[model samples]
Target: MGFLPITKEECEARGWSQPDFVLITGDGYIDHPSFGTAIISRLLENRGYKVAVLAQPDWNSKKDFMRFGRPRLGFLVNAGNVDSMVNHYSVFKHKRRTDAYSPGGEAGKRPNRAVIVYSNRAREAYKDVPIIIGGLEASLRRLGHYDYWDDKVRRSVLLDAKADILVYGMGERAVVEIAEALDSGIEAKDIGWIRGTCVKAREIYMDEDTVLLPSFESIVASKKAYAESFALQYKNNDFITAKRLVEQYAEGLYVVQNPPQPPLETLELDDVYGLPYEGTYHPSYEEAGGIPAIKEVEFSIISSRGCFGGCAFCALTYHQGRQVRGRSKESIVKEGRRLAALPGFKGYIHDVGGPTANFRGPACKKQLTRGGCTHKDCLYPAPCSQLEVDHKEYLEILRALRSIEGVKKVFIRSGVRFDYVMADKSDEFLRELCKYHVSGTLKVAPEHISDRVLSYMHKPNKRVFEEFSSKYKKINEQLGLKQYLIPYLISSHPGSTLKDAVELAEFLSDNGFVPDQVQDFYPTPGTLATCMYYTELDPLTMERVYVAKTMEEKKMQRALIHFNKPENRELVRAALVKTGREDLFGKLLRGSGRTQNPYKKEPPLRNQKEKTRSSGNRGGQPLKKSNKRRS
Candidate 1:
């Protein structure tokens, strides 16, 4: 099939007066299943709807928004794969220099709060037509959320965007249901009861089955209320157990969010991936370096969706839900074969996993029917006895991909939950992973070494990571592979203090490694950690969390983590003195500019050998551009 029309001329060439749905996005058009725009548009087209794409439109005026000439059904808007503000700025609140989603890796292509901007402009162009917003930005801010950019709690994006409805989560099921509803002649405002949607209620809403959260006014007035509100929203994310949630705005008007749509089963997931995607950036971008985001995903196959590993800083729990879903091994193998045939295929499949690489299905059998428990996490503090830890299916898919012609190596760059690997009864997956999947280094995110800080991050304790590391090394030894472990760490998380930062620095030093990059906790919407960052309270426990909010502290945390770097000596000194650990100066820093860190003794493990980084790379390579927390 030909690509979806992106302009009026293309729409006419397809013999359509107007598109049934105009998939408006904030990123350059890449018809790859990895992109939400491609997935949703293809789903609509499969249902016989004429879908047009309006990607990275000119939001300063209504001209581009009107180019589709009033979508026959409605306008579906999103701020692309990543949130726009995050896409534009770094954790230090500095404007980012490049946008992988833009045409030429340029920044500032999309406005701040892109969902609100795009929706408003679409409304300006056609005030009467329905404007439905979804994707990361809209989905995260679907309720009264703490906006880090604004440093305040803002009402739902539906109210601010003047959108008819907001679709949250993995939106395939929700968008299609809404489209069918609209096709049957339901007005957008009247279409309030669809699952996975947030709509402004015309009348005050009260129902026995629906949950009521703290009002926007209440959350704004009190941080405790905000924490409580976030906690309530987090708990009701399960499709089987969740009730319709309503948040009060004014007395008469409310925002009603229906229970999330049920996650697609295997056959349905297969169909979505089986769509006729062109598997590359739209040709219109050829002159402008071709959406840099496509480079990371073009050779990748998304074998699954959703994550059961509930990390506090991640938004997956809020967006993708805890329930896991997977495409059949046949479906993924087909995609891998197609990737091999692509013009630039070089005998490498970049990735063959999803949110969590090893998770091919739900964490346990009960989750498929009963849903994930709201009270406890799947893998945090400790793994539940009932948690089903299996990697046999994921292994089969990888083995099949490796056997495909023209495929040399299948890498698991997306990441694996080290704790989950430890929980499993079998070591077969780890041994195979060490033998085949890992390139030269297996990248795992321990996030932090301090148990105190890790508790706040909802990550496994330092011991868990250490145990996993030891096992990985043993497996690599048996396979005679000289592989290493590149552990990803985060600093200045919600409960992190200067002491915690110092502990992490010492751990890195003792391990004979320093991170090439360190991630500071960024406060974005819709995560338990973000709520903790704003409210200074663990919304889950109502206990106060120590947060390092100032830029100075954030920098100090970074200085400590990379204390071996000569440039960070002063910052490290400052951090040591401030944390009342001046004695650490001698241990953390011992020499002049030539040999800044006098190398700690190494363990017998090969991973302990330190090699100089030429261009800020850890070991094998610099992180892929698409790398996020198991994203």
Candidate 2:
């Protein structure tokens, strides 16, 4: 079973045998957010198509096709699964590496190894079947990228995965296009015209190449570049540059950017809610795994898609859109009931959230049929007036799900928009949120505490996060929930400097959320923040600003926020002195070590000779042409 599976009776009624498609995942881990495999599978099944999911298959054999025999439809290969996952490297970064070496868990297993494994099995078993690749791994790696570890350029994931077609963006609409075309006797080669897809062509025109440029791997070298390429710009629905990249590189790559899907109409919500669901988690849960956070939770559900915060480092807005599309309250409550029925199920449900769980409606209904939205937002910085600020519907759903039989406690455990909550200013909503959704702690991102950086990132000001935190604390205290806010902070975003980072560090120290995880900005392609990161711009004016890209500078800023701890104190002091900020070292060292962060001990140097050689070359000039030629 995949994250969401269709019932056998439904399959029988659809006049399908077994399934027309079988989806594959990597990492071997199943039970996760209804990601690429889950959503894609459900969509096809809803159309009376037969579908089956092989959550994580044994990588040992090509004969694995015998497991499913043959499907009348085709194959949907989602490397988005455990085995196919890559870390924060941009498409360009992926291309620069020697083969596919992902350092972040399940990656870096050896160059070109993941593709070889999936492709070899598909080629051997389902030679004639259409194999469509989609999801993060395939989407990001669809073009060449810079390989930070190996320091070289590489080919796109399509060339590597050898799948028939590569789907990009939020895949629902394009997926429907593919299915419709395939059902009508269209081949994979014809899928290029569909938006949000990348296909293969023998030749491409040079002048028109920008739209089809295979530079995805090349563009993501800097966090800022990635942010600018994908992250939202206020009021802007699409990240223009990211869309351009898709159009340019899409020529040769059968990639399509299907027009954005519309928000679920009111009348359509009931049918979605009426779909049969089984909450029993998939059996092959550990086929592949990474990111301990997913494993930590027992179960999870996507309550909605898309966000409106317009953070420069985030890509969700670009791909999923800012408009909120949600499953009906009945649907969610039904899923909750299923999970409770699972044997050995604890009383607690891990998570019930989405991109921004509290958000539950479209950006605007007028934009739906007009095709062109004049609102500054959905395109740039003004929030459209048509955007509603309502939590009533979402709150009702939450309460109903909690009432489901066997469900002990339900948690709202994904990204929460504190700014949105503060805007509603509803004490009833706040109190309900604190008492029902939280379990000890709630996670919220206030990417930075600096005024300039916050503006640059399109995030709400620190003042808002602070007010929300204070109010949330009050609510928790009144309810006796013992909850606290786990503020997620990002470092090294565009326009963020040592000075700004220091301010953020001081704020964190003063606010008493010490040693929390702080991310080193890794620019994802197709984000608005990437432009700022690459250019270091003013958030409001989009004017150029200063940025720090060096590793040492990044480490020092990271250490400052955790200076209260002994291990981080020395690191922060060393970093400060190195960056000419030694004056703050004394003040930073005043706090005593309180607790240890979860960190693995580094291994000793494998060879002294390698270390000596590296140290000797630290500041040395490059070898002369003659010397190089002689060698």
Tens-place lDDT digits, model 2, residues 112-150:
345446655776787878888876556545555433334
Superposed on all Cα atoms, model 2 deviates from the true structure by an RMSD in Å of 9.9
- Minimum summed lDDT over a 10-residue window in model 2 is located at 622-631
Tell me each candidate's RMSD, in Å, in order: 5.1, 9.9
lDDT values, one for every candidate: 0.85, 0.56
Evaluate candidate 1 by giving its C-alpha RMSD to the native, one decimal: 5.1
Q: What would the TM-scores of all predictions be?
A: 0.94, 0.74
User: Which digits, one per residue and each the tens of the lDDT, describe model 1 over residues 173-246?
Assistant: 88998999999999888887789999898675567778899989999999999999898899999999998888
Task: Find the candidate with the highest TM-score and give its number.
Answer: 1
